[model samples]
Target: MLNYLGDKKDERMKMRNRYRKSTALRCDAGSRCLISVVIGSLMGCILLLNLYSAIRPADEIGQHIHLRTSHHLHFPELEEVEEENIQIPPPRKRSPRATKRRPKKTTTLIDEFLDEDSQIRHKFFPDQKTSIDPMITGNDSMFYYPGRVWLDTEGNPIQAHGGGVLFDERSETYYWYGEYKDGPTYHAHKKGAARVDIIGVGCYSSKDLWTWKNEGIVLTAEETDETHDLHKSNVLERPKVIYNSRTRKYVMWMHIDDVNYTKASVGVAISDYPTGPFDYLYSKRPHGCDSRDMTIFKDDDGTAYLIYSSEDNSELHVGSLSEDYLDVTNVARRILIGQHREAPALFKHQGTYYMVTSGCTGWAPNEALTHAAESIMGPWETMGNPCMGGNKMFRLATFFSQSTFVLPVPSYPNLFIFMADRWNPADLRDSRYLWLPLMVGGLVDEPLDYNFGFPLWSRVSIYWHRKWRLPQGWNSLK
Candidate 1:
């Protein structure tokens, strides 16, 4: 009887341990759900608060706050007569040769953006007077003029085009690293498309996220070495950096190919500093699969992963990096197979992974799709275009741009910064950057692969704005 009792007690102990483990997992799941709710709620509150403030009467807000009285105004009071508001310049007439070739349709934001002579071009690429000058104050503070030539602290247009942002905790500064294309844009071969001499990766540093300081070329292209992968005649685009703690190195992975883009491999570089004269290690097809338009993501736990469009841009492959982040581990899984997607930018929120990708259109705007997965791997769901607002044309054109990065705002949970490249095939170097507010909330409009009838994640939306700024005090919160 004692032996039988002991056996029963052992069984009970095992059951208790199992029960405890199950409870812990349940609690974790519950915490994740709570986090999602809290994030969604906070975003909703911010949106409502902003809307209220926008609609609230200016007098009402003034009534609540105390104002200092002075006989001689220290700051100039509103001038009674603002001579008739500055008149908008008239639109320029299109060349007869151009009009004769093709009739102009109703002008679009894209048309204005593309037309070098459009009256609205000034609005998109503002004059030096309105550039992101560090000396500028008021409404211009922390404002990003997407597509406009952004100048560094030295009063020169920043060269980091097609870039990515990396926030370095070690330096407490955000580094914007990208291609420094300062060469003439021209076609390579007789039939080849527009190309430019590989200029190298540029780096810029910023504390307030507005005024940037040029850090010079971190990785310069080989000029004389024709066999070199980074030879100036070759192609290099979309350079992204992520710090690896285990290796204690800043690693950069970029698209490296020839003039015709036949060498479809990712080139890896390593540097001890963020401003890198990175040592070019090697280039290879990740998992022996062709990679193009890729980005690396570092998880919260210090595990860096690579996501690249592979199989001739038919699908995307994702895999965790080796502990050192130098090589892709043997284990890799193909996600979004046969999807024909490229220009991938990924972000995670509320324990759910989201990716924004553009269709494989060469240098033209196309509809963007947002994909979601419970895990970062298989069984992804394709929701419709995430763009909202603006006229139908703007939404369809993705605000006239292509996906490059989805930057999470530290202060606002659901709010994210959507960065895209507005390529000008005519002048590759003249391509512009598009940064807009992206929010992940509201009901998922479509079905998931496995969750047939259930809505598993919130709908991702990138709102189009002629001009917009982050919510006030957002930086302070961060």
Candidate 2:
């Protein structure tokens, strides 16, 4: 009986010990689960904060800090909405035979805009008397008069039409590149588009945006090679240059096509210097599709991309270039599909991509649309016409101009120079450059198809001005 009692007590003590060990194990597991939940919650909160910072308006987050720090960069003068009033003159009387051949349709302001003999032609293309001469230093010095003749340092009108400006960090100068259309303009066939034979790509250098020094024909046309792509009979236009840091070379890309414009392709050229006699490498149809009206953009991360009108100008394709910045990769995403956008001038701000595009209206100025995307290759949403301050007709016609490039102002957040071409189809070489202030801020005016009533992008405004200049000391911070 004594042995049995002892054994029973020992067994009871062992059972108590076992129960305590199991309870301790359960408590440890519960503590571990609580720690995991806390860590996971922290990570999720961080992700949500980052996402909010990206999509929020510039003024909401740190734009106030920028405003306080860079008060000198504030451009209240540029932000002021300047209205324009253009009176379309009465139509010229047409002859009976001319009227009979073409039935009398209701004439529009666009008709007057295209007519060389339009009474308001001077309004669109002012004569040399009111040219923007950089040499003449007075109250009007450094001011930009849009639609007026812009003379280079040599007292000759700048001939870089459909051009883009590159700010070279090494030399700290801006280089402008475009089609050298100093040659005569004519139609190749009865129905061919009016074009100036490939006189070559022109290069001009400038310390300030004003006062350009001609760099001559950087890439000349082939005079004798009838089958060559750069032959005088072919088309070469919208040449853009971007520097490759890895290769330390300047790459030039332009639209190459036949006079008939059926052979649409892009040509590439490279040079060691900004003012270049570039070697024409070759031309190709990127992704085996017809390309025209293209532009190349070098991102802040040193990656370059090519955006071109493809599939008969019904859509645009965005693709990354090779590491050397010479060729496109197999990766291509078609954005703005079926929107019929061309003249793509892309710029990024506050981690968002913005583009200004024109309609496929040939030389005639059409409505300009601004698009925004969270990613470069993305589902870009159209944000309506960016033209502001101008009258109804002026806004409708993109201020009588087509977008060529959107140049960011150094050290000035959300400020850019909107460069465009006031095309003169009758006299192609006499085209004028329209530089206006483009600001990215405020809520988007149009509702997005997605987003469920929430604003997803900022408004891109290209404010029109008859005469405007960069803020007094815009380049001082540079």
Winning model by lDDT: 2
User: Each prediction's TM-score against the native?
Assistant: 0.75, 0.84
Error of 1 at 384 (Å): 1.5
Question: What does the lDDT read for residue 148 in candidate 2?
Answer: 94
Q: Tens digits of per-residue lDDT for model 2 on 177-245?
A: 988888787888888788888899988998889889998999999999999999999999899999998
Worst 10 residues of 1 by lDDT: 75-84
> Which regions of candidate 1 are displaced past 4 Å?
1-130, 449-451, 475-478
lDDT of 1: 0.75
Error of 2 at 190 (Å): 1.0
**Model 1 agreement with the true structure over 416-446: per-residue lDDT tens digits:** 8898887766666666677877877655566
* Residue 210 CA displacement from its true place in model 2, Å: 1.0
Compute the lDDT of residue 52 as modeled in candidate 2.
82
